[model samples]
Target chain A: MDTNTPLAQTDPVISDEEFSRFCEFFYRKTGILFDTQKKYFAERRITDRMHKLGCATFRNYFAAVRFEASGEEMQHLVNQMTVNETYFFREDYQLKALVDGILPDLAARRNNGKPIRIWSVPCSSGEEPYSLAIYILENWADADRHDIEILASDIDSAILAAAAAGVYGERSLQRLSPDLIRRYFTKQRDRSYRISNDIRDSIDFSRGNVVDPQFMRQFRAVDVIFCRNMLIYFDDQSRRETIEAMYDCMSPGGYICLGHSESMSRISSLFRPRKYADSIVYQKPFE
Target chain B: MALVRRAAAQIAEDQPSGDLVDGQERWVADLASADASIRRRAAHDLSQMPDAVPMLCAHLANERSLSVRSIILTGLIVNKSPAVVTGLLPFLGSEDANLRNGAIEALQHMPDEVAPHVVSMLADEDSDVRIFAVNVLAALPHPMVPEWLLQVVLHDPHVNVCAAAQDALVEAGEPDVIPALEALADRFPGVAFIQFAVDAAIRRIRGG
Candidate 1:
């Protein structure tokens, strides 16, 4: 089999039916759904994989994906399909909700004197956890009245190290206003800005995987969690396990903000849907 | 008060009490603990045990807390086997909606293990069981999902059962299933919702 076959000349064309079949299979495997709009994108990636494998037809490629015990090909497809760009305040409506709605509710209901804990799993490159800190400090009037502990984690140790280092390029800071950026970050010699030492020091950044039960066990009584865009890469069982683990670690009435495209109702019945401001979040039932 | 740093020692203080050395028996015993958190932890630990499926499934029935029930179901899903499916199949008939839905959700994740049972489940005398079987197929990743759904739409006498199949076929059906879907609409002409659902399924399968 010649692996260098030109994709256009020799690659088997994917029919609409095959595209639908592949989308369903892919969605089930990774909880990431592709619609008709993504047909071109999906077909291009799949056919590229087929060309590299020298599979003459979609059927042969799909058969390998479905029946292969090692699932290496499937992982490659997942990597091909997912987009992982991150920046500060990319989905800031949820941040607005966090300051305006979620925090006030949490603060009012809290009788315990313990510090309120907010966790950000898979906190890639520190933008999200740092954004949470800046949002609360700048917007929430009660920020000075309550002790807040921000915990950030990621499965990649290198990314976790980067998150702890709290440095960012201009692209990652595009969404921040100049005033807020000036307040929270110090301009570095490299023309990048490093988040202030106080904001960086306040967060406890650690390496953790959501699907690992032992790793998930250390988090307790968490008040809020920003676990966005991470679960879409996980298969069904892992997604369920991750949600259930988060449930156990969270305090009752605690809220979780998933990526806008992700829905808790699709994953588990453990959390009730709570709409705050313009964003929808899931809340652990107070039972 | 302001943003505060929690020491690593403080985080360690939050770890659950039981250790791995507690043995399977201790974890099994803790499955019945009055504390829901302890029961949840026991379920998490028991997921590692090879033979803990039956215990977890049994505990799921008596487990009152939704959190514990979720953990028990996750344990069942993680340890998915024919036995796990057998333990969960009964829940599809459960009067408790939560348990039934939870069972359906868990079964969806174990497509290979649940495949052998799909035929019996879809052919069950209970119309609700048949509907639940279709519900399972709605998300089950198996390639045979479309064929199983077509079987339900073509032969099932219950209108709701056929409707359930049509709902699933909206996503799982191929263009070949369109004729069967049309025939289904013909089979239940008097039912407006059935006609509507069948038409929608046909349009969707056709990518209209």
Candidate 2:
């Protein structure tokens, strides 16, 4: 908490006593290997949390945080470690690709016959799926709406409630055209807007993990799965596991999505990056 | 904590503000260098800027390094720029709640602009973001903030958000917050945080 704590004191040249607690604390908690090899700039992050919580020192906060059984302190710790900066429909290109290339292809593949279910795995706060639902409802016909389903899932149960409600302010909806708002949204109040059932019904709000075996059911019949931006958190093994799982559940000629920077070529030969003019989507190999 | 301690030590050792700036400039130059040690040192040095609050706010978006960004958040609430908050407007719909919360936190420091978004966050269903939005309303001035805070304080799923809502109500009260808070607490006794929050808000509202 002392404002006097200099940055150099936080540097690698520090004595063993100064930041050893943080070195042990973070490395143990996240398995993020924060030793001499990496020289992770931990003093500021660790100490800042200590100061904010009024724990006096990193050592004190570390003891309380490391020993805690339930995840509150641990969750707070992870929150401190991560710098979350996201907005709704952040890469319009990704969803735009869905509206143009992915949806049409899926609809045609169905021969306008079967439901085109899409899953936004780890759909925190509903933005991803709601955006997906909105894209489908607005660009395509509600008459064709029976053809698509978006199952939005997240590991966090608490965030799912917010995603289910689908309310937003003028800011969250700033990019949204007013006409689109009028067509696809139900105004909850002067300050709020909720996606109309026309869009919300396409999303089956639920809780599922990208890790456990239980998650396979949610992806059972997905034609196009847009799992963007969540892969950055997974370790190699889990990433491979999830990629395999997503591949397994993909219906014939179904597609898969990942964060813009993620690639499927490295994961498996079964998924060929579906090259389009403006975007790169992935498709399952035709059996 | 080390930053505070080390800054205190450097204050004892350093020459003048201009020299510090020169040193800071050098560090900034090396921020993206291929040398790992230099990058590490630059990150360490950057975390110590006395004017870090304003400087870090300016540099926040440009910095690609997560370590540096985390360090920026680590220091005393810098990046308190109205611009930083405004820039985040596009990201409001981001599926990442952490990003949403960061934007919310950045917005909290700018009181005039803070009210509108804080109001928006109160209505946000994500309990964490809603709770954080309530916290921003706590520090700044918002008349409507209380009603919304009390509403969530009584009902939110995340205990922390409820606590923040209760605190915001205490800081900035509305006429109906008291009765509504009391009723909510009475209805949801299971939420001990809400009950405690109601007690605190009611006590404060009665002008305690």
TM-scores of chain A across candidates: 0.86, 0.68
Candidate 1 local lDDT, A1-287, one digit each (tens): 33234446656887777687777777666667888787677777888888778898787787677645345688778777777899998899999999989999999998788788999987988999999998899889999999999999888998888998888999999999999889888999999999999999999988878887678868888999999988877766788889988997799899999987678876888888888889999999887
User: Which one wins on lDDT?
Assistant: 1
Number of clashing residue pairs in every model? 0, 24
Identify the candidate with maximal DockQ.
1
Q: What is the C-alpha lDDT of each candidate?
A: 0.84, 0.59
TM-score of each: 0.85, 0.43
Q: Candidate 2: which stretches are off by over 4 Å?
A: A1-86, A141-146, A188-190, B1-208
Error of 2 at B56 (Å): 54
lDDT of 2 by residue, B81-124 (tens): 44445555433444655444555544544555554555566667
TM-score of 2: 0.43
- On residues B1-208, what C-alpha lDDT tens digit does candidate 1 reach at each position? 3899985336767665544456788888888889887788888888778688887888888889998898888878878889899989999888899999999988987889989999999889999988888898887767777788889989999999999888777654456888988899999999999888887777665656
